[model samples]
Target: MTPLAWLAIGLLVLVLLAIGLGAWRLRALSHRVGSFECGARRAGAAGAPWVAGIAHYGVGRIDWWRLWSVSIRPARTWSRYDLVIAGREPFVGDGPDTYLVRCRYHGQDFELTMSRAAYEGLASWLEAAPPGRRNVVV
Candidate 1:
C-alpha cells in the first residue's frame, strides 16, 4: 500500500482507540452519578427495582425508619415501595410535594428525578409504621 494510505489507516486506528477509551471512562463516571438528586454513586441499575429487597441499605439512619410491622391475623396486603426515590437535587421548591421521593431503594442513596405527583401516588406504600422505623435490612 502507498505510504499515504498506511498513514491514514494509522490515524483512523488512533481515533477509534481514543473514542473507545473515552466511552469506557464515561461509563465508569456514570456509575458514580447516582440517579441525579443523590449526587452519589449509584449502587444499582437505573430501572432495577427493589422487587423484594434482596439486601439492605446498610446505612446508619435506620433509627428513623418506621416499617408497618403490624401483623394482620389474616389480612392480605399489596406490595409497594416503602421509600420514594426520584427527582433531581438542589430542589428549588419546599415541602415533600415539590419533588419525588425514591419509589424504591437499592441500598444506596436513592433513585431521583421522579416527580411530586409520583410521590403522592405512593400514598399506600408510604403508609408504613413511620419513617426510618425499620432497621436497615443489610
Candidate 2:
C-alpha cells in the first residue's frame, strides 16, 4: 500500500479511538442520580455571572460540565465538606421557577442556578451531613 494510504488509515483509527473514549467517559460520569441544567460563575464577573452547564451530583461532590463541552473531566467540582450555601435568590430574568444559590467553596464564592427540584436536592445533600454534624442552608 502507498504511504499516503497508511497515513489515512492511521488517522481513521485515531478518530475512532477518540470518539469511543469520549463516549465511555460521558457514560461513566453520567451514571449518577441525575443531572440538572445549571450555571456557575466565579465571585468576580463583571456584568452578569452565569455560565451554562449540567451539574451531576455524586457521593460527596457536584461535577459541573459545560453545556457544549464533550470532555470527560468536570469543569468544576464542589465538595460537600468545603461548600457553604451563602444565600439564594430567584433567577432574575430566567423566570420564577429557576433559582440561584450563592455558595462559598474552598473560600471562593460561586453562584449556581438551577431548577426548584435540583435546588431542593442540593439543599438536602448539603444538610445531610453525618448525624452529629450539621450544615446550614437558607
| Top candidate, metric lDDT | 2
Clashes of 2: 0
Candidate 1 deviation (Cα RMSD):
15.9
Q: Which RMSD values do the candidates have, in order?
A: 15.9, 3.4
* lDDT tens readout by residue for model 2, 8-89: 9999999888878767665665565677788888765647757878888877888898765567688998787778888888
lDDT against true structure, model 2: 0.79
Highest-scoring model, TM-score? 2
Off by over 4 Å in 2: 1-32, 44-49
Which digits, one per residue and each the tens of the lDDT, describe model 1 over residues 25-96? 444433432211111223356555322110111122211111111221211111233343343333343454
Error of 2 at 126 (Å): 0.7
User: What is the C-alpha local distance difference test score of each model?
Assistant: 0.35, 0.79
